[model samples]
Target: MPIAVYVLGLGIFTQGTSEFMLSGLLPDIAHDLGVSIPDAGLLISAFAIGMVVGAPLLAGATLNWPRRTALAALQSVFIAAHVVGALAPGYGVLFVTRVVSALAYAGFWGVAVAAAVVLVPAEAKAKAVAVVASGLTLATIIGVPAGTLLSQSSGWRTAFWGVAALTLVSLLCSLFAIPGGKVSTDETHTVCAELRAMARPQLWLSYAVTAFAFGAVIVTFSYLATLLTDVTDLSEGWVPALLALFGAGGLIGMAIGGKVAAAYPIRTLVLGAGTLVVASGLLALTAESTAATVVLVFVLGLAGYVTNPVLQSRVFALAPGAPTLVGATNTSAFNVGNALAPALGGMVISAGFGYASVAWVGAALGAVAVPGALWAGHLQYRGPRTGGVVAQGAASQEDPAAARARA
Candidate 1:
């Protein structure tokens, strides 16, 4: 497992860059392909749509496959996708390339998360999950920035080439590193049974909680460059640095979330959501000041990412029956929220409210999420205390117990 996590993380990091680097490359992509910025934006939407639609459907279809096989196959498809994107003849072909590349996000990341849990002893599940999940954070921290620079220096298409190369490395690593084991939950339950897990009201509740929290972050960050240069009045070079700072905070948050969550995941869930609400307000107001803006942006990233590990941990506690599907669907919810936030934030920005307005939109939506967190809290109180008990058992071991609780 030493290299397995790194392998999986690298694979996911490549996928993450392919999926998210578009925002940074949008202008170049638009102008190069003879399309409008809005048209280029659709590429982002297409990738996200692929993820939201693909996670469960792909999981169900590949339900019986071994974990390593499934992951390798998905990443191979992603590599082909980036290659196609690099060599695309026109917008249609490139768009399809994006959709194809995006297909890897949900299934691979989901399987990877489940794999991380199973790869270690029962005590390290949360830590393992965090390590795997860091791929997305690292994409933001390292991949996106590096990809942005690559796009600027060579061309946006070159970034795809880079990601494709990374995927090849990941493929080799997956071949060597992943130990044979069960990654899919559908072996015990039918795909129908797994799909039925979504029918439970708690699943929808989990979706809402995740949807809003992540949505809040994306809405503002989607237009973050606009905010920094236009609103915050920072120079162009400062944008990536600021974005990286946010990612750094996310790195810290992801780690802290795992550590603190063992004691009271339920409380952490609400606290994490609430932090978004307050942080959004602070960011919206302070965005005009360079110093305050930078500090708040870092804090925002920290608080925003803290919810991810906590939310994943909560979903596992609630839906132990199908943790793989649960984890997969939760990832879908994150993108669903991502798909939503910017569109809504766009309407405000379009109305001439200014760049910082997106932050307020994020704030309002985040405020709405707090109540959902509270409702989840009540559900925890009334319903299964099993997760709480397990979390308590986990608390004693912290990371050690996390690895044990994978079952």
Candidate 2:
């Protein structure tokens, strides 16, 4: 692993903190701005919308720039946006700032992931991505809770200020650490060529695997606090601790996934999603038991995150030429899953299914992804083709010995 990869992870950590910390500060924001809690919650939706729209748009717009320059520019914009958020006069200003910050974050993620892939050997691509993604897991475990605590002790604006400061540091690190050069092959990729690459069925299947697998995980996870308090009879204070435990499990899962995905991408997806189904089903059945709930939460996190590296790596494998655009769109897919799953889970709970029912919803989604994963694997085995000649670009990059060993 290169030092630059870890720097990218730090950049992601700053972004992740800003993204997830909003959940913890919404109440304070609502109170301060004289808005309803639901209105304040819309800040999250604004960020998600920005991500879905900005990922591809910004990525394509900057497709011609050097990777490091794009990353630096995006992070700079993100940091400035957070500073504006920290100093916003009212809810509307904050909302606009959140969307702007998210656009920068989305653009940064696309460029960062594509840059990480370019920085490492093909055999290490998944592991490199996992390293970057661990920053998010770390944020869940530490940053969000810490920001919540800060908001409680000081003010919500203070949390934004802290995030802005951290982002500035991350931007500095990126400027100093990330190599400054165009990806040699990527320079030739015209917008039309990238669009053509994005149109592949295999790539769409890869996106499906990303959306479904992640949506399945979020279905249960989105309502976990309710399940813990209402069903398992845990006190409200225990929720944060248990959530941290879940994140700890995710960190472990991501580390393991990184190692395995380089060799066993298909198996990583299948087994990870399979475990998620089982874990979610058991969670639904045993929600009344505190011990069982605790155990299952960690299992759910583990199973859920283990699929991330596989999904990310698959998108790159499927569209090797359009990695920046495809990777950005894959990030959009994850956000789509994040937005859709919770709404579906909330509907189930509203229908008197109880909080545990979300797990069953998750199980069904995971089941749907099983065949999707297999379909992606089939495409990978078929290999990339152009006209009659097999395009060996991505396939040839893998270590033959590693592939055979996995076989």
Candidate 3:
């Protein structure tokens, strides 16, 4: 809703680009640095590992810093890291640079999400998160492919340079647009206060739902190209376009979900997770049919991303005292899903199950999350009677009408 929220989205677009563009440039990077493809692939893992480690670490370290200052400083660090990465001569240097960039990106994300919600009304928190996260969907459609194209036309280093330049633009936008102040207005903000909020059972339940819900999406996505080619019998050239179609569907889903997630958190979670399960199961059964596969891919993307805003907003709602830390942990939960799903999908594919089996794995993950979502809803309705910080925080934002109806 605010220009600042859009600016945060732009910043995430750049970060997401850097996060995913490596997939397309890995071969070039391996060839240039005289490393094997598998070793170069570790660079992706390095970024993920960095994100998982950096989110909570940097969030706590900078928890007391001004939100705008933290964001701008992190972006500067990201730009510097990318510049160095672009110029690095060897695999080791590039690998280190990836870790550094991911740390900056992770910290920026935690602060940015915390800042975005404070800029809007409690009822609009999910919308604000959706606006910020839409950047990632856009990156999936435009940035990664564009980076791949630039790398193909120039060099992989050129793609890194491009990301650095784009990040500079985002940083400037953030400096000018985001409000200048501490994220928490409370004078007594402390790391211990934040840590204490993490004691809530509902908060941990929400994290599990976050991981399982998103892992369901990523597992199938990680194997989509192979399924498209090997099972659906599509040409290699169609992969990017099909992936873009998936992104297009995600953008649509986010728009729809953002409008209602705050008022209908449980319904949003149930429908989104249920749709993902159904879509993945259908894809698994119909992978041989090209038309069916294409349709299901779009459905999968739509279902997968519709849960994004709910997953994020519910965390902030449940842990109002620790938004920065909660956001950082949620980010870690997301990356955990991202890393684990691909490994699980890879295992399935290697164990003599076909590429389509990844969809079944995805369905199972989604199935696990459905009950978690129901449990979250139950906690929301019943837990407020205990009257702790978690209950107070969650109650502050939950839609009373919807809560009553569910009860």
Candidate 4:
């Protein structure tokens, strides 16, 4: 991995931490601001909605600009999000800020992945995506945990301030570390071109893989704080620690996911999905044991995250013609999963199912992804020249060896 990769990784951490930490602190914000917890939950939803809206909106709007310039500009938006979040006067202000800041969130990750892949050897593309995504995983481990602690000990506003500072540092790091380049020349993606990529049966299968995989994870995570406080019989004080453990698992998974994808991307996802099958059972079973619960949370987190790098790489591989939009929209797919899981999980919980039911819901969600991975595996086995294997656009090499061979 290059130094620039590490720089992007760190920047991602700050951005991710800022984005996710709000969930853990939702109760605190609600109480202080005199709103219901459900209302506070909107802060998280608002951000996702922004990402869903922004990914395509920003990517299409910025379609013709330099990647580096677009990335730097997104960081500026990140800082602005922090400002609004930190200085938010009331719930309405906070809600608006979350959405606005989220616009940066969706666009940054989308553009970052496309640019990050080329920074390393072609074989390392998944690793590079994992490196950038590690920022997000680290946010779960370090960023969200620390921010929660800050919100508890100081003020929630202080947590926003800290994130603002983090984003500022991310901005500086991106400017200093990333080498300058044009990145791509094929900038002609018609509405039909994008739809054409989507038309690929394998691409839709890949989208299903991402949507379900991420949905399962978010279903578990979105309600994690409640599970700890309500079912596990832990004190409010211990929730952040448990959440940290969950995130640490994500960090570990993200760190290794790239290398794993490099050696056997399809197999890794196959194996990862199977773990979710077991993890969901274990989480439901172990909801009463602190130690057992801890281990299960770690396992579930790892299983959920291990598939991320491979999925992103697969989307780009399937749709390299419009890599920017493809990457952004794939991110939208993942977020769509995240968005839906919580809604479903919330429904189960509201219907008087136990908090542990989220795990079961997650398992069912994870199962949907299996066939998609199997389909992609089948395609990989069949070879690209076969009837179903259409390169959605010019190939952006997922296999550096394959790219080099063609070169």
Candidate 5:
């Protein structure tokens, strides 16, 4: 609950707006750059690729720098990337810019969550992370819709320019607000040490849970507008409003999830994923009714994000020694889900299944995480005996209070 936590959230909002707003601008970008809509859609994939590559790599590469310094530097690069994107002349240039921006964005996210964790008490770590992540929910609520409106009225380039300006503001806020100093020597480690921390089976299971659980959310969200128009009989003008409703549900879910994740991480994961499975199944069955579609979309968003804090906190807890790298890897896992789920959803839609089929895909992905979460919980209860010798050593070195908090 520190002021710095809110500032970090503000910074995340700027970066997230840049990331999510592009989905709304794809049509305008495709027409303006003389490309097909599918081609323009590749920009999303390019960003995800950059995130998966950049998160762990950049976090390890910058392991020696102060967290505050790393965050400021990454935000500067992000702002510059958006400026370039705003001025891009063709599809190739825009695509390259999106990748570059995403690299900086991913690096920022990797460091930012670790930084947030350090700023709060062990008991408040999940809540702090939730505060930072709420920025993304807010982006879906306010930023993406506003950007889409701007693109509709002025030009797609204008949305990019607006993001650049907002990022500059966030950059200034970070410079002034975040405390200055390197991470404690005890928390810092060599590249090999960090790599060793990642060798835990439990850690990988946590990542798997993150990937599939969140992927379920994206499967339906990636084509929500299409679903509304094609099946629910909604007008195009209502898409943004409906998306905002989903974001509202996300905000509510994150608030509730943060409150419970610290004490019941695995239970929260199972319940959250279970909620997604049920919500998605209902959505698939009732997509034709406008009332049902609206209700289910909100429920889907709520259930999908309820696990965010739990997934993030679990990863950090699993690798207590390598917070930065572990946090980055977890971010990468979420993006991996983001990248793969949409492709799967697209395939289902193209195979002659209706838009509602995406919900079934989501349900299956969510279902996969249930057992994964249970297995992780079983591992946690059993201690680190089977988690790999290096990871066990790392966990044994953690503070007793911290370990108890995690339990």
Candidate 6:
């Protein structure tokens, strides 16, 4: 809804491309750095680990800084890290650069989310979030493919160079577009206060729902190609196009959720999470049916992504005391889901279950989120006060109209 939101989304596209494009470049990187493929894969792990650590750390450290300043500083660091990574002489240097770049990316995400919500009216908060998060979907659809093409035409180093150049454009757009101000003028957002806000049981419940619901999506997605080829009997050539279709589904879901989640957060979560369970279960059951599998895969992406904006908006609503820290913690929860789901799916496959079983595993993971969302909704309705239904911190910032709408 705001220019800054789209600018931040553009920045996220660059970072997400950097995050995922490496999957395609692993062979080139391994060959160039004289390492094994698995060893080159560790670079992705390093970035995930960095995001988990840096989101809260950087958000806390820069909590008091101006939002524009923090964003600019983080993007600058990200671009610098990419440049260094492109020129890296050895695997070790490239690994370190990847971690550094992820830290910047995570920090930027934490700050950008907090800033995005406050930039719009209360009714449009989820829309703002969807706009920003759409960048990641776009990255999956457009940026990663373009990076792979670039790497094939030039070299893997050229991909990194391209990201650095793109990030410079995003950085300039962010600095020029985002308004200058701290996320909150409230003086109570001290470190101690932020820590106290983190102690809310309801907030943690929301995080669990985020992790489980989002993780369910990743479980199936992480193994999608294998499932498509082995179960659906498609060839390797169709993988990219089908994956783009999934990304398109995500964009459609986000656009729809953005329009509705502000008025129906709990409904959005329940329905979205329910769709994940159904889609995954159906996918598991119908894996051998080519048409069924294709349709279910698209449903999986739609169901998975529709919950994102609702999950994010709920966190800000539940923990208004420390938007930066809360946002960062939620970001970490997302990465946690990302990390754990793939491992769980891998374990399921290792246990002699076929790739189709991973979809069942995803269904189980999505099932876990349903009650969590219900529990959160129960807390929201039956808790202490009108505005601060879930936590004392939320009362200070919760929109009365939204509170009444929820009522």
- lDDT of all the models against the reference? 0.76, 0.79, 0.82, 0.76, 0.80, 0.80
- Candidate 1: stretches off by over 4 Å: 34-38, 185-187, 196-199, 383-407
| TM-score: the better of candidates 3 and 4 | 4
lDDT of 5 by residue, 1-407 (tens): 99888988998898888777765676678789998544665677678778888898888777777878988899889888888889998888888888898889898888788788889987677678888888988987888878878887899999999999998888888888888765434554777887887787788888999999988887787777667777888876777787788878888888888777766677788999999999999999999898998898889878888888778777776677787789889989998887787778767777779878989999999999999987776666554344422212344544444433443
- Show the lowest summed lDDT stretch of 10 residues, model 5: 384-393
Per-residue lDDT of 121-170 in model 2, one digit per residue for the tens? 87777678788888988987788767767887899999998988888898
lDDT of 3: 0.82
- Lowest summed lDDT window (length 10), candidate 1: 388-397
**In the order shown, what is each candidate's alpha-carbon RMSD?**
4.3, 3.8, 3.3, 4.0, 3.6, 3.9
Q: State in Å the error of residue 24, model 4.
A: 1.7
Candidate numbers sorted by lDDT from highest down = 3, 6, 5, 2, 1, 4
Which stretches of model 2 miss by more than 4 angstroms? Answer: 23-42, 87-94, 183-185, 230-233, 348-357, 378-407
Steric clashes per prediction: 12, 0, 0, 1, 0, 0
**TM-score, each model?**
0.89, 0.85, 0.87, 0.88, 0.90, 0.84
Runs in model 4 deviating more than 4 A are 180-183, 186-199, 382-407
> What does the lDDT read for residue 184 in candidate 3?
72
Leading candidate by lDDT: 3
Clashes of 1: 12
With a 3 Å backbone cut-off (N, CA, C), the pairs that clash in candidate 2 are: none
> C-alpha displacement of 30 in model 3, angstroms?
6.8
Return the TM-score for candidate 3, rounded to 2 decimals.
0.87
